[model samples]
Target chain A: MRLAQLSERSGVSAATIKYYLREGLLPPGRQVNATTAEYDEEHLRRLRLVRAMIQVGRIPVATVREVLGHVDDDSLGRTIRVGAALWALPQVPEPDEDDAYVRAAHREADALLDTLGWENARQLTTISPAYRRLVVALAAFRRLGYDWDAELLVTRARLMHQAAVADLDFLETQPSEEEKVEAAVASAVLVEPMLQALHRLAQEEESARRYGFE
Target chain B: MRLAQLSERSGVSAATIKYYLREGLLPPGRQVNATTAEYDEEHLRRLRLVRAMIQVGRIPVATVREVLGHVDDDSLGRTIRVGAALWALPQVPEPDEDDAYVRAAHREADALLDTLGWENARQLTTISPAYRRLVVALAAFRRLGYDWDAELLVTRARLMHQAAVADLDFLETQPSEEEKVEAAVASAVLVEPMLQALHRLAQEEESARRYGFE
Candidate 1:
């Protein structure tokens, strides 16, 4: 298929396709002529994956390039490290806020993680910078009078990160690549609300169990 | 009494305070003279609240303004609507790559919520947008590939959200604001990890209990 056809098939614009090609994020298609380039099924597949990573994974272009490179290299060790690193970045705030808040949160999270004695903690180092930025910003709030010493908050963050690691570990154990990817995507999507909801429900159930005035 | 003094006391820069004032997000403090504005404790409280909405709750500036208006009105009914509206915005992705990826997973969570008959589910809405976003993103990925449908994902999300909600209700039954906030924060932080760990442990324990598998 030509560039136009590829764009139509893949739901990506021809401009973007060219940009990807220029950036070497996508390999050039077979040249039919000086004026034309022909693409194939692989290009379509690659485009979808790229979209997934950018639109769905929210990976930065630079990181996506590195990850795609790592995946292509097929180095199992590097793949694992890259994957773990990719998954370890802290969540971004909405906007117009300073980086300090996320830095503070990540710092608090790290301290909590340390307190929990989590092993192989270097897997999270990639996220430390962003987290530290948040923490610093949040420190301002603390100075302004919000409670920073809430042990429960610290414990909760530690536990949540620990749970994420465990879930990722389990997801990684899936034998099939397809299933692993599915589980990876699904786990990311499902875990937060699940956690939020579980806390709500569990507290209710536990409360009722413990203190219901029957 | 001046911008510098306010900045020092608030830990918010003069630039930001100026932005807030211009946007009407922050009310003008008492003007002491032609060159000086005197901010008081109320400005500090409002500023902290604004930071909380942005940093903690992840609300945007425009919505934050609306919410503050409602807060000032003290019309609980209108405030609830404002809260709900504010909750509907997407959780901004963190700068960290991993956090962004996790957030992207939430695309699927919307479908899962619908599949689980959880559309307009009140309790889930009350918690963090980050949680909700993650659930939906995961659902989107599942929809794109694999046999995993929204039904399964929704069930998990609902089960989790319900747990958290029940816990909230339980905490609310108590009299102390401290306990309530502690419970809310605890639920926010620990619920995900707890559920993830509990599920993993339960699966392992169940297998062992029933089939002699470790």
Candidate 2:
């Protein structure tokens, strides 16, 4: 099939098909003429797999390209390699933002730093960037005279990060490499909503219990 | 003190502070003269609270304004009203670009829907948008002839959501409202990382057991 046909079948635009081909996100088709190319069933399949990595895994194009190179090959070694590569990728931090809040966060962080003992203080940067953002918010909260202490926050944060690691390990289990990939993809994509839902459920249940309403 | 002193003390830049004032994210101060206004410790504290809400809670200004109207008011009824309002605000979703891979995922999702006996497949629209995004990716995986089905995915998702609720209830066993709020805020800000960590840990343990390598 031509690019147009592939686009129609896959629900992707022809221009995007070309872009994917050019970006090496998709393989080149068999050249049928100077201006035309022929794609096959495999191309359609590959297209879907690509979507899975990007949309579900939330991977960037460059990283997806590397993973695709390994996954499309489907050799045991390559699959292992792809998994290793996925592991090597740094855990993503939170969303991007302007420096206004970021700067304020840094300063307030210094005050919290003042309150910590050496054992607790060790390396403040050990927290993930996402957590760093939270620390900043907490710093602001501190200014409000809430009287929440730094030690408790740090300890809770460390415990939470540990728990998250545990969850990831649990979610990734599957009998086969294919299953691992499937679970991994699902884990990555479903995680944020799971967190949100969990927060609501936990808060509601806690509130009910505390208020003696339920 | 004046704006400059408050700005220095808060570490939030004067310009951003001005913006916060204009946006009503910060409360108004006593007008000292035609060109000056005097803000006190309460103003300083409120600025930090606003930062925490925006930067930590990731709540928008409008929502924050409504929440604040009730949150810090001395009246008990108002605080209760604000808490209720906070729960009712609509979640604003993070945006992502549509791409070829997303198209593939949608197709896989459609097939999964068929298999799962989900009669109102269109009900996906009412689910969290994240779930819809995942369906798109999962659809792409199906196109690759993977053995995964919708049953496992849905089951796991439901379970995880349930577990999160359970965790919140567990936290509510704390003795005081202050403790509850502290735990809730910490959980809200830190739970995602904790969940991610937990997923990783569980998957690792399961893999070790399945492979008999531990």
Candidate 3:
């Protein structure tokens, strides 16, 4: 198929496709002649993935490239690949003041995982700097007068863990290596919005139930 | 107290507080003399809230202003105030192609809520445009070859609804109208990062448990 058909089938404009090609987001199609190129099913698959990352996942092109690079590398383990995808996400900056509050939060995060018997919780910070930033952010919640201690964080983590288990169960069934990697990356990137939307919906329902807002 | 005291108490810099005053994110303090101004506890509280919205919540300054505007309006109902806060966050753009795929996802979102017996589920879109964008995003999941339908969505929503109930339980105790509004807005804005971080931590733990990677 030519670039035209790829654009038509993918619903991406030809010019944008060319832009992707130029940016190395999309691999160059096979040279058919001086002015034409052929794209195959692989290109179509890659195009869809790229579009999903940018358009749906809202990831920047550079981050998308980095994430895809990790996915394309077979030598990297699956865990590392997942970490890479997650690392590409925007993260909250850690508080500049390493105050007692920040240190307490870190301890609480570790202790929460310890109490839950989650053996790998402490290792999370080492995997991604975002995890440490997350801990700091959680501590900042206390400053807002919300008593979001380790107990509350763990309870919420446990619930979301169940959902993650369900999501990963589906990922385990993908037949191809490439499919599995793409699924993992998509799960990491896409599930955040899905869960957040669900969170807001739940908040609305809860608010109505509590406040009698019809 | 004055601007320096307000900064000292809130841990925000004088320059940033001045910027907030300039941006109208914080109200101007009362005039004390020709060159000095007096700020009270209200100023301190507003400064902290604005800092939380920008630094921790990662909300854009414009949206923060809009959300604070709604909060400042005493006549608005609690539901509307909550909606305003939800609206202020960054949202995913809805899929442009209103194809069968997009429509199917919408039906799936509705069906998921229906099956869950959640009465206020449809009201989510009315509350926040993010919900509609979320539905379209779920459709894009299928494009990535993940079989996420209404069933999976509801299951996740149910889990998060439980968490939301837990979060809102604390709001019941605030005695003053201002406290309630600030708590509601804080919950709506700050909880996303907290939940997202928990999600990531849970994912890491789950991945390690399944893959045996330390």
Candidate 4:
């Protein structure tokens, strides 16, 4: 298919597609002649994935490019590939290390992970900023006199893990490593808003039940 | 306490606290004299809350001001106040209204809510943009041929609702409406990173278990 057909089929503007090509977010189509190129099914698939990453996942283009590089590279280990994809998603910035609260929060996080007996807890260091921020947030909640229970956090993690396992089961079935990587990354990044929306809805329900807020 | 003491106690820089004051995110301190003011514990508390909203919650200053306005206003209904706080939290941008996919996703969202028998589902329209974006993201997942089950979503929601209930239980005990609003908003915003971090950690655990990775 030509660029116009690809644009028509994918519902992406030709100019945006051209921009993606220029940014190397979408690989260039086969050169047919001067000022013309042919896009195949692969290009269409990639275009859709790119759209999902940008439009739904809200991943930055540079991060998407890096993530896609991992997706296309076969030599990288699966753990690193998956980690790269997860890292591409947005997260909270880490607090300054010198801050007393941040230091305490990191200790709290380590203790919580230890108490939960999560294997390879130190792998959290890879996403340390987000993890550290979580700890800081939890500590802030505690200072406000809220009980952010360690047990409760573990329970929530377990439930989310169950949901993820189902998603990963499907992901594991993709026909190729590349497809699997794409699907896994897409699932990790795009599914977040769904989870968040459901959480808000659930909060509404809980609020109604607790406060008679109908 | 003076501004310096408030800054020292809160661990926020005096300049930033002054900025918050200038921005009206923090209420002005009591005027003592020209170029002099006195802040009390209320000011200190508000300063901490403002910092939490900005640093940990990642809420924009404008939204923080708006949310704090809701917090300070005594005449606003509880539901509206809580809604404002929730609204102040970051959310995904809604998809285009005219897009067929987004329309379908909205329909899907409505149906899912109906199936769950959630009360006052129409209130979703107030925050429809974020909700619609979530539905659109879910639809994108389905388009990718992943079975993102409604039942699965509900289960996740139930689990999250449980976590929320635990948090809200603490919120319910606040002695004043202002305190309740502050706690509710802080929990709504700051807890998100904690949840996301735990989700990622859970993903790591699940990945390790399923794929036999370290």
Model 3 bad stretches (over 4 Å)? A1-4, A18-41, A88-102, A139-148, B18-42, B60-62, B88-102, B142-147
Better of 1 and 4 by DockQ: 4
Name the regions of candidate 2 deviating beyond 4 angstroms: A1-22, A26-49, A56-60, A67-175, A178-182, A212-214, B1-5, B30-41, B56-60, B70-214
TM-score of only chain B in every candidate structure: 0.47, 0.45, 0.88, 0.86
Model with the higher DockQ, candidate 1 or 3: 3
- A best-first ranking of the candidates according to their lDDT comes to 3, 4, 2, 1
Q: Which ten residues in a row have the lowest lDDT in candidate 1 chain B?
A: B205-214
lDDT of 2 by residue, B91-124 (tens): 5343233755456665554554455443332343
Residue by residue across A147-189, what tens digits does model 1's lDDT show?
5344534444444444544555565566755445435433443
In order, what DockQ does each candidate have?
0.14, 0.17, 0.50, 0.38
Interface Cα root-mean-square deviation for all models? 9.8, 8.8, 2.3, 3.2
Residue B191 miss distance in model 3 (angstroms): 1.9
What TM-score would every model get versus the actual structure? 0.57, 0.53, 0.84, 0.84
Docking quality level of the chain pair in candidate 4: acceptable
Residue runs of model 1 more than 4 Å from their true location after superposition: A1-23, A26-45, A57-62, A76-80, A84-107, A122-144, A158-170, A173-214, B1-6, B13-23, B28-40, B52-61, B78-147, B155-214
- Predicted candidate 4 versus true structure: per-residue lDDT over A1-214, tens digit per residue: 9999998888889999999999998888899899899999888878878888887667789888887887887777665677666666665555667866567777777777777676654565545444665676766765543444566566666666666676677677778877777777776666667777777767666676666552
Give the true-structure RMSD of model 4.
3.6
DockQ of candidate 2 against the true complex: 0.17
